[model samples]
Target chain A: MAVITVRQAISDALREEMERDENVFILGEEVGVWGGTYAVTRGFYDQFGEKRVRDTPIAESAIIGAAIGAAMTGLRPVAELMTINFAFSAMDHIVNEAPKLRYMFGGQFKVPMVIRAVGGGGRQLGATHSQTPDAVFAHFPGLKVVAPGTPEDAKGLLKAAIRSDDPVLFIEHATLYQWRGEVPEGDYVVPIGKSKVQRPGDAVTVVSYSKGLQLTMQAADALAKEGINIEVVDLRSLRPLDMDPVIESFKKTNRAVIVEEGWRSYGVGAEVAARLYEEAFDYIDAPIKRVAQKEVPLPYNRTLEQMALPQVADIIKAVKEVL
Target chain B: MKKEEYLELYRQMVLIRRTEERAAELYQQGKIGGFLHLYIGQEAVSTGLVAARQPQDRMITAYRDHGVAINVGLTAKEVMSELLGKATGMSKGKGGSMHMASVEKNFWGGHAIVGAHLPIAAGLALGDQYRGGDGVTICMFGDGATNIGYFHEGLNLSKVWDLPVLWVCENNQYGMGTAVERASAVSEIRQKAEGYGIPNERIEGMDVLEVKKAAEKALAYIREGNGPYFLEIMTYRFRGHSMGDPERYRESEEVDCWQKEDPIGVLHRWIVENKKATEEELKQIIADVEQEVEEAVEFAENSPEPAPEELFADIYAEEV
Candidate 1:
């Protein structure tokens, strides 16, 4: 095992997949010559050549639509949307087209494609640029939604997504690129929908994923120091949400807090809380608390943006409230 | 093309017309649900374009896709079954009028969104290009689709990558109720292709032979690695856009004028004038098509609805 940043882990996964499969190619705006807007594929152009590392026009519909087409034809394409905010431009293809093609066609077509999008807010990019709309994509049935919290999960889950014969929306948190964690050496893949117990504890259950997982982990550490141990469950995949670990952890703790970087309403927290109530209602000791972003358009101001975002303190507060 | 091929083209056009006519009746009877877009007059466009394609070449089109499905070798039974929403349908009853496709026949899909399939067509060509294959992707859409961003992006990418694709736009006068003059910046749809640096042409879609010839030239040009070519086939729909369309946009006189140039009628006249087939043979083809459509309706009616468990099936190729 080697410790690496989330960015490095993702880059490694993409490189390994490309090397392993000849049909795998990368396409998006600034993905080739400009070396990716996020630098996730910085050196891929030079290594893979122009045919595989394609630099597309600034058209999200074309980027995603073409990727879907390519996937339909048996080529595995990893399409990057510069940012998840820009995904709205190609929303029709992402939600209506990609997910519906296989099922609507009665299993005649398979979209073995991965759409890697950078999400979350903290750098003060404003309402249009910053968003954690993971739940929105997860709302669809056919498409698989995977968002990894740590470097290990990022590499493993991304590899699994590429190999799966389904369209996967692989969301990477914008602020967690530098977050470091240990990743296994080679050819390892974590299953897509299974939630993992990041920190085992019995006091209270904390449910989160993506950037929220980072904050929850920090909160868990802080609470542990104060003799309040909380269990952290990282939901690796949002769509095929594996509620087994969550329910199991919740049954043990009897109290729970759901944390997410998105809004409190109609968000991941809402779904998890509802499910927890439905499945493990007998174990409940208190009302499940939810720590999430303020239901407001993320502002450009740094302080205000941070205030809108769910922080480690917010997780701690929610966990304590549930306890 | 052989005399048999000409007769086959004529047979396919008549088959599409008869199938859609029966489908209209079924829709009225409440046997077929959702929207039913007929391809009564514009049969020559898809029939000709599909005939020009090699077996390896791919074809994709918009909602008025029954003609294309028939052209690409889908049986009248398959098309009618899909129309009736049966388990034996082309999309196994999932995709209705606008979603018939056969991977075995290299017909990618029957996409409903206006210009959405254009980029996907480019991607199909790109996949072929990446694999060093010479197969061309022929994507058909209506004139109104040219106004959408997907058309521009798909065309631009096809040229930039020099992908092998034939972008065929069936300029059927109006988009739903609005005419091309009102919906598009330029009425000549091929001019939009010029903006993307792709070679293009406008063709008459009333004559099947003419459409076939133009498609052959365009497909050859793309096959020779000359990049994408756009063909704007000027035609008119003989029926309303969909089953319940209140076509208040045009006059009966205009419709009559275009109806006089009906593609099936034009093909029938051409065959008789050119001595391609006998009057008896032409009559026999029409009779055959009517019988096929009748049998298809019976087959679809008798076919089972998809099993209840099928609702959750094929959502993903693998278990979630």
Candidate 2:
């Protein structure tokens, strides 16, 4: 198996889907001839031509809205917002129209659409350009929010999202784009709403996703040297959250620490912690601890930005608190 | 326009006006529930556009869409039953007045959320063009919706893709309670199309003939592969925005003045001026429409609500 980065895996998934079905098309700012903001769609324009590979204007709302419209009327559209922070402009279409159409109209219509945006903070892009908005989307009932932490996971879950009949918000971490991992070079799909245990242990459980998953792994490795074996759970999907693995892991570990890059207030980690207490209260040996970014606007200064987001040390601290 | 065509437009507009008047009565009597946005004075816009559309063409509009449904061949009975939340309604009583839809009629929908349906309208046109079908979509919304971001996005994309769609604005002078001048930065609704470089025109919406003429030009432009067209129909709402509206925003004289330009009255004058028919024939048509509307109300009032067990049925295509 060839090693591939998360960026390549996503582009490969898109290319494979486009090759498999003529109905699949990609549209976004700087997506076609300009490659992409992250160059994830390099060489896609020449192969797909102008029809299937489109370069849209800097209108995030229009890009997603058009994709939703196209998806409803037969095409399977994969709309790319340059960054997750920019997706707020299109929140109405994604949250209100795309997700609710199937239920509001009594299942007479379905918006088979996927909105792909790069999220998570580490690039010193400041507050406006750097944010993890998955929890905000997760608050909605009809949407399916997927955050894949690895290249293989990205490839597999994206295929699943494109094939599904519901609207899927496929969020990728900007910092994880260059991280490499072995990916299967064939047809595969990782079902949505499933969480995977990356590292198994019995002392404590560290749950996270995207960049948070990487930090959790680092923290897990550091904690192991101290003889405190920790289990790391990468929450692949957030909306239809797969809490079974988390609860079972908690039952064995008896302690848990959830991590997220979004702000602490009403964040995904908070939700995960709440669910842990609700399901496995008796199994827990201690109170659940959370590691999230500070609840303040991210500063553009390097030192301040780094301090605002959760690091390996932060996860380590949270793990120690839970243990 | 020919006398026959003018009379047809008048007939459709009169039917909608009378039907909505009866609907107001139903709401007062507690037969219909939910927030109902009546398409009273704006009847000419729907009738005019539907008259110019091809049989295979599609149509979509905002919540003020009872007129479009009726013009697209849904009987007053079906519409009335839907409003009454009867099981025999278009959406099996699941969708209320603000969310009516019919796939078979090619009417697309009665979407809420201001200008949300514009993109869907573009998609319908895109699909028709891609499939080599000689059809187009007429997307309708209120004057207040022109200020929305989706309106510009949808219009620009329609122009960029050269999609076959007629974006019709039924400017009834108010967007809910906010007047056109209050909410918009630039209040000339027709000029809103300039940013997209699409052809646009402002028409007298009170007259059915004028609306039909403008719609005919717009429809021909789209049909000829010239891309999307926009029309701003200057009209007024004879009733409040909804059933519970206090209507303290506008003066009583304003409503009375617009009522005089009622689409039906305008049509009747034209019919009399052209000597198309005696006054008795027009009166008979009105009586027949009223009878049809009454039967529809009876059917809706007697119809059953959805079964209690079916609440969980249509949540998904199948069980999640």
Candidate 3:
């Protein structure tokens, strides 16, 4: 067993895929010699040359649009957009072109592309860069939105996104890049649109994703100290959400709290909460509780920003309120 | 010039114009549904661009694509059937006017989003060069699409990659009723090519011969591995932007001014004056084209609507 950061896990996935397939290439701003803004592609340029480890202009729409074009003809392109906030520029190509091409053309063409963008709001990056847009992507049927929590799942799901015949929106948390876990050093792929149970308990179920999963685990730990056991379920895939594990956990616990760092209204938490009520309403002992970010623009001050987003204490408070 | 060749271009332009007119009529009837962008007067561009390319080459264009689809070997019957939402249509009635694609005919697609297909065409060119195939890509778009950010992005990539792509901009003077002058700084569409270091020329799009010659020159450069070239065909749209558009942007005199330079009329005049064909012979060809279009309409009307279950079928391909 070996410990690795989420950043290293992504690097391993890209390295393994690039070795596995000659067509798999990486293109983004500062992705090559700069090793990536977050070091996700460290030493990749030396290994893959300039063609595969391509450094592009600071044009998000061009980067994604070119990847869509390249992916359609041939080649499995993993395009990194620095941050998810920048994806607004490429939304037309991503939402209109990549997803609809296969269906619009009656399955004559498929856009095998992966758009990897850093997301979440914890580093005081402020309102512009600190959005969690899981709901926006999850609303689209053709796109598969994945946000993995642990290093192992990140590497596995990313490889899966690279190999998918359909376009996949793979989101990673910028703050979680340096966080570490044990990931096997070999060829492996995790199927998309599936969730995993991070920690199991019988008192209350906690559903979260990306950095939210980390907060859920910490809350589970803190709740364990108070003898209020909680099961933390990491929802790796937001679209085509696997309700089996989520429903099974809800049945075991009969009480649930969804933790998300996005705004409270019409967020991914709202979807999860609605789905839980629809599927396991009869099995629940109390109403579904949701812990999400405050409704205002995220403040830049460290203490205030920390308070704005959901934390372990927030999850604990929500759990106690529901109990 | 041979009478058949001259007549063919005239018939093609006529067919495109008539089909778009009929499409607009159907849009009013609410039969052929969803954004119906017509390519009424810009027929010479599609006919000439397709005529310039060989079978080995590929082509793709923006939403106003009924003309290009018909010119590039898709039967008018197939196009009309698609418009009618019939099961036997191209794309099995899934793609209407905007998303028509025939992979077998090397017709890549009819992308709805403006300037989106430019990079796709460039990539196809790259694939052709890599495979050592004697193929080039003809990417067509409206003048309004020229101002899009993807236009610059695609042109720059094509230049850097030295891809075999000919970016043809149909400068019809309006992008959905916003005049080219209102949206763009330098309304000379050819100058947009200079920004990406790609050579470009302006062609009188009302003449098929002129568009054909310009396309040949652009294709020659692309085929010779000189990277991408640009051709701006100054054209016009006789009708409103779509079926329901009020068309309050331009004056009636502007439409009358462009009608005098109609591509079909120019081709017909050339056929008669150059002694390529007699008046009687030209009328016979026109009659033949009209009959073909009428048959296409009948074929579309008689075709069956796609099954409700088919809505779920074309989302993904399943290997047998």
Q: What TM-score does model 2 achieve against the real structure?
A: 0.93
- lDDT per residue as tens, model 2, B45-114: 7887888888878888999889998988888888898898888787767778987777777887888889
lDDT of 1 by residue, B1-320 (tens): 67898899889999999999899999999999999999999998999888888998999999889998999889999999998899999899999999999999999998999999999999899889999999999999998888888989899999999999999999998989888999998999888988988899999999988999999999999899899999999999989999998888889999999989988888888889999898999999999998999999999999999999989999999987
Instruction: List clashing residue pairs in candidate 3.
Output: none
In terms of DockQ, which candidate is strongest? 1
Model 3 ranges off by over 4 Å: B1-7, B119-134, B275-281, B316-320
- Docking level of model 2: medium
Give the DockQ-based CAPRI class for model 3: acceptable
Could you tell me the TM-score of chain B in model 3? Answer: 0.96
- lDDT score of residue A33 within candidate 3: 96
Alpha-carbon lDDT of model 3: 0.84
Better of 2 and 3 by DockQ: 2
lDDT of 2 by residue, A85-169 (tens): 8888887888887877776665677777889998877778888988887899988877889999999999999998888788899
Instruction: Give a tens-digit lDDT track for model 3, residues A2-116.
Output: 7999998998899989999988888888999999998899899999898788788777777887787678777888999999999988888777777788888877887788999
DockQ of each: 0.87, 0.51, 0.49
TM-score of chain A of each: 0.99, 0.98, 0.98
